[model samples]
Target chain A: MSTTTLLLLLVLVGVLTYLYRYAMIGLFASRSLPAWLHALCRHIAPASFAALTASGLFVAGGEVVFAFDTPRPWAALAAVLVAWRTRNVLATIGAGMAALYLLKLLFPT
Target chain B: MVQIPTSAGGEFLAGCRDEAPLLLGVAPFGMIYGIAALAAGVPAWVAQLASAIVFAGAAQLVIVQMLAAGAGFIPIALTSGLLNLRHVLYSASMAEYVRHLPRRWRLLLAYVLTDEAYAVAVLRYQQRHAAAADHAEHTDSGTPAADATADLRHWYFLGAGFTLWAGWQLSTAAGLLFGATIPPEWELDFAVPLTFIALLTLLLRERAGQAAALVAGLGALAFAALPYKLGLVAAIVLGLAAGAWAVRRLGPVR
Candidate 1:
């Protein structure tokens, strides 16, 4: 993409994102949320984030690739374990990256 | 709701305080965004500007990747917007808490309505409001009695936001500057998926959450071939449906 097009696209995306965020605050500013809606909103982050993460983990070259031999699943498992045990994001990512690199080194195809 | 008068400086500090723990989670993610943006062929200036202008890590990463893959602008914009749709839910949740504040305060809070800030602020608000309700129930059944309101949560958010904002900008710059130096053989590319896995594990603290995560994971895998990144969107819808269904069937935690 040309610089101008990329810049314009970035600007449009940014404004749209801001609008998405501001839409709720604008609509609900003067009122309390219904209990049911509040309950539903509580699940939004986890569910959306899970989807984003899952797609990134398992998809490769426009296809689903799942197997024990793949480096990603094992690396992700290591990261999940570190995150669960330490509850630290940095350590989890670092460990995951390290594990993947080590696996690639040990079992090159 | 008790109103606490705070100066702009106080409000900014309050924002920082609420965001500290979340900054820990966000910083490395920002670093990953930096690296990925470069690897995806986004120019250095554009990548750095993304953190300042867009300021949403996942969306920025996805957008840059799509741009590199020759995706159309409209699809990129839509995907970015869709990835950030949860922010709307967060904004709505936080609106009631800050509604009575001045317009300026509300506007500032709205601009800084990030996932971490929203989570911490909402949790604090719920805890405080429940305490206030309990106190009022015990002391005077009908009357709205005087209540002690703590505004520390606002400071917490400021701490988190400023910290994250700074980290994002610097990390993106670092990635642009040093990304070429890093060897592809190192397989640092796996960091992206790993980071997500760690984040997902954190969210799976409850049985319902676990079930929702599993459903989303499987759904995304099954629908991975959908064009224009629709698989991610499908996974989100299915995950939300699964969670809502689970909640309806199982009821809330005892």
Candidate 2:
């Protein structure tokens, strides 16, 4: 793509993305969401985060690995245990990273 | 509207603090994005420019990857646009919290909205709302418990957003400069999953919350092959539906 074309694409995406971010806010400005959507909205946080976490741990470079041989799932198990116990984000992440590096050293995968 | 007694500065700082834990995850992602851009032959200056304008990690990375592969201008733009469709949900969920702010402030906030910031901010709102509701019975004493939180939510949003903005820019610069040599030992990308797990553990206080999270996580794994990130959206929708069902079935415990 030419420099001008790249720039144009970038700008177009920015505009359209901004619109996606803004449209719902605009609709929601004047009125409240109905009861069912309200209930669903309440769950959005956990569900989305869960999906992200699972994908992060299980999917390596877009490929899903169900086998226990992968480092991520093993390390993530340690992370889950630490998080469940400590409920501290910093500690959980630190432990998970440390576990990953250690596993990488031992397993060399 | 009754004004909350908390200082704006205090609230902002609190927001920053709450967001601080998540930044560990963010910086690595930003660095990877930066490295990916340079790898795709996007000039350092142009990469930074796109970072500033686009400011979205996944989409910006997709732009570089697609462009490097000789994808046409239209698909590159559309791919990024599709990647951002989930933000519409974030905006809708957040609209009620931020609607009262001035239009300019609202627009700026909307611009800064991202998954990390939105997650922390929404969690904060949930906590504050719960705290306020706890004291609703004490309103006979005329303490405006919830009112203070309304204003604080916006300030927190700003503070979290500013931190993410700075972190992203700095990490991207580092990645551009030293991406190849960052060393695989760091395994920095793992932070993203760790951050989410930590957050989920901290946030899951009820059966409904548990249900939503499990379903979403499993669902995403099951639907991981869906193109255009639709799997993510589908997982989220199903997770939330499960949560709502659990709430209704369980009869809403505090």
Candidate 3:
């Protein structure tokens, strides 16, 4: 992309982001949130985070690859297990990395 | 919500302290974005400035990656917008908290908001507000009131947002300057996912949360073939809809 386009992209995202951040806040500046909306909003984080994690773990080079040869799924499994057991961020990260390295060594692809 | 009003400085410091652990994860994640952008052929200056301009780690990375893949500007912008649409929920949730503050403060805080910062800030807001609510309840029952409106809430938010901002900028700069030196084998790209996983784990203390995450992950994987990464957006929407259904079926976890 050209510099002008890159700048345009940035400007577009920047403005939209501010608007997203400002949308409901501005709309209901003084009003209390309806209970239904509040409940729906609560799900947004969990769902979005899960989606992000899945893409990061399962997709590479714009494709979904989940064979045993790839370490991401295996390592992510290890992370999920550790995270489930310990519920600690540091432990989960350390375990996931270690699992990835070990799988890489074993699979070598 | 104390006998004495806590100063804004105190809240700010607390915000800084609470963000310490998240920063540990963000440090590597920011550098990875810097290096990834450069590898994708984004100009070094634009790549680095994108960190501040977009200031959102995931969206910024996606934009650069899409650009490198020869995506059109409209697709790139749309993807970025869709990816970040989640922030609308965050801002809405936080709106009530900072609504009383000035528009200037609200705008800055909104810009500074990120997934990590929101995670920390919301927990603090819920806890602090709940405690104040409890105290106010007592006062309504004839107990003496004790400075119920004394939360330095905005300062706490500022402290958290600004710290993440600084960390992102510094680490991105580090990555751009030294990205060439770092070995490719380290797989720093994984840092962002790992960080998300950690955060997701923490968010899964409830059964409904677990259900939402499971469905969302499966949904994303199932729809991963969609063009322009519309799969991720599908996953988010599906996850949210499923989670709301689960909550309705099982009742709110809280």
Candidate with top TM-score is 1
- Candidate 3 whole-model C-alpha lDDT, 0 to 1: 0.75
Q: Which lDDT tens digits does candidate 3 get at residues A4-108?
A: 888878988988888877776675566655677666656666776787777766676567776666787888889889988998877887888899888888878
Model 3 bad stretches (over 4 Å): A1-6, A24-27, A57-64, A106-109, B1-22, B39-41, B58-100, B114-160
**DockQ of every predicted complex:** 0.54, 0.45, 0.52
Q: For candidate 1, give the docking quality class from DockQ.
A: medium
Clashes of 2: 1
Docking class of 3: medium
Error of 3 at B129 (Å): 8.2
The candidates score, on chain A by TM-score, as follows 0.72, 0.63, 0.70
| lDDT for each candidate structure | 0.69, 0.73, 0.75
List model 2 lDDT by residue over B1-254, tens digit each: 22333878977887787788877877866776777666666778878777778888767755765555445665455446645666777888888777766788788888778888899888877776676667776675323433634456778888888888888899889888886566645656456567668877887888998899999899878887765455666777788789888998998877
Error of 1 at B81 (Å): 3.0
Deviation from truth (RMSD, Å), model 1: 5.0
Question: Fnat of candidate 1, please?
Answer: 0.66
TM-score of 3: 0.73
Q: What is the TM-score of each candidate's chain B when compared with the real chain B?
A: 0.71, 0.66, 0.71
Query: Candidate 1's residue-wise lDDT over B105-187, tens digit each?
Result: 56666666777667766765676667668767767642222331444445545555666677678777876767768876665
Clashing pairs in 2: B4-B148
